[model samples]
Target: MTSIYYIQVEDRNSMDGNRSNTLAGLKNNFAGEKEVLVFSNHATEITEKYAQSGVKTTIYQNDAYTIANFDAVLTKLKQIFRSKTDYLLVFDNDSLGSSLGSRIAALLDITFVADAKKITETPNLTVTQDIGATSAKRVIPLAKQAVITFSCNGVAANEPAKVDVSSWSLNEQTKQQYRQAKTAGNGLAFAKVVLAGGKGLGSQQQFKPLMKLAQKLNASVGATKAVTDLGWLSPERMIGISNLTVKPDVYYAFGISGAVQHTSGMNKSKQVIAVNTDPEAPIFKLANYGIVGDANKVISQLNDLL
Candidate 1:
């Protein structure tokens, strides 16, 4: 059986080489299989190198299918697998990987498993994955076809060999305009006031007050890596190393514990005010003004005052 591994070319460098490592692990797991296909958005030097390394490489690139254009990408992907009834599709369990893989699975009506930790083909092809925030494990049976996102730390370099790279393109439909959701813009980098939140906000619903506050204050909304990781906010709103770096004149942090990954992005802000329930939260040390209280209460009080 052949397994298709999808790699988002743009995130290859940002993810600390996890793509190559995961591909190596996949190759190892499906050893002696007919082939392990490398499907990517763009045929970059690195991906082309994979083609040179004995991997079956395929690229589907077009204006309508770029990384920023998920709808177009999704449409193109559905077209690719519309007729396939039995296959294995693999992706890294990272943000982009999981999002794209799961979306594709949903659109194609294919079985989906996320954050896979292990794969075995004994009595049946089953996947072992963590459940309930890593507190437990569950084994899923892959009876026929499935799409999976996996995380592994093992590294395996591809051996050099010759192979051909296959290219795929979208069949251009009638010209049309797409209306996308509001995205965090470069204004975040130049905003005079920024309202940022972190994991301490509790849930995605509880995070709404902070966004409402940003609207009332006419400030840009920012997010800690943890918040973005939880899908509470878009990745574009993330403030951290490798993400957006902001130096707003004033930064209001709600429930932020101030991990270095977050502080590095906004350390240049002229003034910092933080609200958190934990008096010992690290964000207070760097805050020019600190409020030791529930972030939701603080937001509510501020909203009421406004």
Candidate 2:
């Protein structure tokens, strides 16, 4: 069987610098001559670097972005599997395309790996997931087919190379429930300042004051899993595993205990300021500035000052 590098590319119009590096690394690490297959839902086509790398490139682009879902992607994958030997499917951490790839693997009853920070494939494929203080490692013998999602920094997706190639086609169908809701704000992804509330926030009413403060600062508001799960805040505002990950200039956490799951998403912030009444809170350990004080009181003071 031949080894095929199947990548799900998002931001289809233009390739992200991070993903560009990832493609380079995969090509460099491949054992011998392998096919590079890229997939996208958008109408945008990639650059010509893929073919220039001396590898055969086949791009599967959806002619239109209508009624898209994981099942639609799955339908397409099944078609390609028949002709190809086996595939090493790769996706970016928490990406839409990656999510689809995972679902496709599940439906096909194939092995899948998520949030892999590091991957080395020599004698066998070893994937490492660094979850804060502890790390998990797994080795999978190169299989007939498998799915893997790559971490942003964990695997150094920012390689010093560019290989963007793409094209279009009319794709598949949607199986899941579909509703058109308002699009989520691109705050954590683009905000210079973010104010994140945690489980310490007693109620939804109490969260309003922090939201007001964020607005005054022209900042975006984020929340911990506990608060979001409690239905106190929107899931789009969540910052953690299986949610949106952010790296802002200044990250402000109020009433948050700084759990590893939450911190894993935001620890990359340029500066972190944590406010919790508990002096023993874990957030203080990673915060650039820590305050052992009531979160509401501090927000009030900051609000008055602003």
Candidate 3:
């Protein structure tokens, strides 16, 4: 029987519900054909969710919190692979999955796809990826055994559920190690709305209107690399590449050109609206609705609409 391994990240807060999305996608895609295995930190709440989604097997690790300890998790994965040559879908909790995915594939001597969005099986296994600035789609043919780092957008279709109780034990030493390494940070992923700015906003002074609009909506502020690079905004506010991935209920892009790197981080938003002067700006292509005009003017009108 073909098997599917869902690499569940222990740091759910950091992933911004990405784990849930990935698991849901797997369940929807595989359905009755394959067995689903969820590897997580054994958080009772999260584990129960996966189990309810029809995940037949669940593996819990004690020290799965930090990026430094991912190798230990990989070791256990190797053991699972030894028994069955399964197609492993490595769902990133953050960008950390990108670093560890290839290593896991190398260890198993299987081809690995980075940031893959879709997987299909015909006579051969086929994978699709969104790469480069154009969000170009590429396909790769794979043999039976392969590892894939799935994109969050591709897996957002699955809905998380509250599962019946099924517990697993972990080693005491690993549990102690994880507890000592836990870190604290903001929960930006759970934000209801995000007001993001870009270089097209003109100057640092222009950011005030965006901030004002964000405040009116009670949304957190986000920025593109251009604004951050110019030092007009802090790097922490940047939302692409090395920055945080967001999936807020609503994402407002002001003067952003919609570079692929920037779009990749927030494409999972429930609704995307872009305000830009350039009618052909790349960001407008992905937006659900767009207004081609001065951001300042649009913002002022938006304030009135709100």
Best by lDDT: 1
Model 3, 1-306: lDDT tens digits are: 345666655553233223444555556655335444444544664554454454554545443444345666567667768666545555553456666667778888888788777766665567787668686888888666777777532222223443433333332255323322121113455576788888988899988777645534546778898888999876777788777789998999988999999999899999999999989999987899998988888887765554
- lDDT score at residue 267, model 3, on the 0-100 scale: 93
Can you write out model 2's per-residue Cα lDDT over 74-136, one digit (the tens) per residue? 666767664655666766665554676688678667778877666666666666666656655
lDDT against the true structure, per candidate, is 0.69, 0.66, 0.65
Decreasing lDDT order of the candidates: 1, 2, 3
**By TM-score, how accurate is candidate 3?**
0.51
lDDT for model 2, please.
Answer: 0.66
| Candidate 1 vs 3: which has more TM-score | 3
Clashing pairs in 1: none
Error of 1 at 278 (Å): 43
Instruction: Determine the backbone clash count of candidate 1.
Output: 0
Best by TM-score, which number? 3
